[model samples]
Target: MYISKKEIEVRYAETDQMGIVYHANYLIWMELGRTALIQEMGFSYADMEKDGIISPVIDIAVSYKKSLHYGETAIVYTWVEAYNGFKTTYGYEIKTPDNETALTGTSSHICVKKENFKPIQFRKYYPEWHKAYEEAKK
Candidate 1:
């Protein structure tokens, strides 16, 4: 599988009262990872939006394994876990500098029309991207 990596610096503002990274921050990091993977695959979400197509997360699941502190760097690895013409599931792993997994998750998304919220067939709408995801999943 082709995995894309993104490095993010943990900011103090992203931490909670106990000085550890808040759980909600993982969602943002996952997005960063997804963006990196899409860019690596030579696709741009902005371009999709321009075409009146919007990809939204239909489901997500995350598991936290370790705590992260401010001033630390987070390494996010992302890949297409599954693609089935209608839905694409992206897998993610957030790791520490030592390469230990801090969080693991998957986010499933579906493409929809911007005008109506109606789901669109991804393969028909973006064959190239669909192919990329299919290949990446393997």
Candidate 2:
């Protein structure tokens, strides 16, 4: 599998009252990881949007294992978990500097025509992108 890594410096704003990173912030980190993965694969989500297609999240699953505090750094690992012609699922793992997993999750998305929100096969529009996902998901 092709894994992309992104390092994030936890900020105070991402913490809760108890000074630990809030649970919801991990979802943001997952997005960062996903963007990094796509960029690593030589594709830009912005370009997809310019083409009048949008990939919206259809499902999400996340699990928290450890708490991090402000000033700590976390590394997010992301990869394509599954991809079909109509949908793609990205898997993610957020880890501490020591490589201990703090959270794990998957986000599934489907491409649609931005004008009418009709579902579309990603391969029909972006064959290279679809092939990349197929190759990476192995």
Please report the TM-score between candidate 2 and the true structure: 0.97
Off-target runs (Cα >4 Å) in candidate 2 are none
> How high is each candidate's TM-score?
0.97, 0.97
- Once fitted onto the true fold, the runs of candidate 1 whose alpha carbons sit more than 4 angstroms away are none
Positional deviation of 78 in candidate 1, in angstroms? 0.3
lDDT of each model, Cα atoms only? 0.94, 0.94
TM-score of decoy 1: 0.97
Model 2 clash pairs? none
Q: Model 2 over residues 1-138: C-alpha lDDT tens digits?
A: 999999999999999988899999999999999999999999999999999999899999999998888999999999999998789999999998888889999999999999999999899899999899999994
- Write the residue-wise lDDT of candidate 1 on 1-138 in tens digits: 999999999999999988899999999999999998999899999999999999999999999999888999999999999889999999999999889999999999999999999999999999999888888994
